[model samples]
Target: MGNTDKFEMIANIYDTSERIQIAKASSDAIREYLVEANSKNAIDFGCGTGLVGMNLLNDFNSMLFLDTSQNMINQIKQKISDFNIQNADTLCFDFEKEGLSDLRADYIFMAQVLLHISDVELVLSKLFDVLNEGGHLLIVDFDKNEKVVSDIVHNGFNQAKLTDIMTKIGYRNIQSKTFYNGSKIFMGHDASMFILDSQK
Candidate 1:
């Protein structure tokens, strides 16, 4: 989960075509479940280079692009300046090391982020606390894949198991479904992605 240096090193070249396409798909999936978002604040949790958040600027009142890597945050800052986006800000914070400090949001979404966390339940609980009442948490990630194996990240996640974990964390009205499938999407193997929506 401590891949801060790894991400920082690639921050400049992270927005490749494949990643951009995935981010686009993720954002579209998130938009489907977003409700009354025009006047709400959002946090793009673990927002890498602001790919997903950038596409969602017009959907929310304000967006906070948050990442653990300063270089990643810098990349987003450059984008924010280049696009003249006024309602977006960047933050460099690590939830696993330091809990979200009074940072609350009406909506929080993470794309392909939960796979990297070592303690998923703890992080989910922290996010739950950070969300405002009646807010939503949207997660876009790879569905369970048995073909891929890795020590640094999970192969994928079982939707039912994840829902159970979120329910235990006090999230309600949980729902999930597969949305996108692509080649070499996860660990060089063809995989499908799912979007899960939960309310606080």
Candidate 2:
């Protein structure tokens, strides 16, 4: 199967775990990075199944959830239905594409999505462009040393590479730390968090 096909096949399983306690904590950490933002508009890029949206629904006044896979967005639509979403919408978007040219947001978020695309710098540039001045970007994914995902399709990337990419992209005072808790992606026996937060 192709990359998207594989994700589509497994998307249901991902949505089913949306409210799990551990996942809630994981999502909370990422959301905390944005809660204090000056603006209420936020975009969750690569918002697969809207897990990030589910965690953040109560915080943002408006949110745009974007993903490349239509099936995954469908899964998110269903999964987030139970939440009290004040304002939320989903779109099929590839960040660097022309269609997203005018889509600027006060805050841009990406988690569990970067490793899928190899053009890390290009993707970051797109996110940077969409942010309002003084906006922030929060990212949570696997660190480079997490070898369990080495052979997996579109797994998290190395921590150092992320640091370099963010600095080169003109991000400021980037901060990152590893979270050693287990993750279902690694069969619940892996350290799953290395978070990065940067400014535009």
lDDT of 2 by residue, 1-200 (tens): 12466677777776554335545766677765765653478888887777766677667778888887788888777755755455888888665454456887877777666766666788888788888888888887766544554444455667777789888888887888776456555434355667788888
lDDT on C-alpha atoms for all candidate structures: 0.94, 0.71
Candidate 1, lDDT over the whole model: 0.94
Q: Per-residue lDDT for 1-200 in model 1, tens only?
A: 35788898999999999999999999999999988899999999999899999999999999999999999999999999998999999999999998767899999999999998899999999999999999999999999999999988988999999999999989999999999999998989999999999999
Poorest lDDT segment (10 consecutive residues) of candidate 1: 1-10
Off by over 4 Å in 1: none
Query: What local lDDT does model 2 show for residue 171?
Result: 85
Poorest 10 consecutive residues by lDDT, candidate 2: 145-154
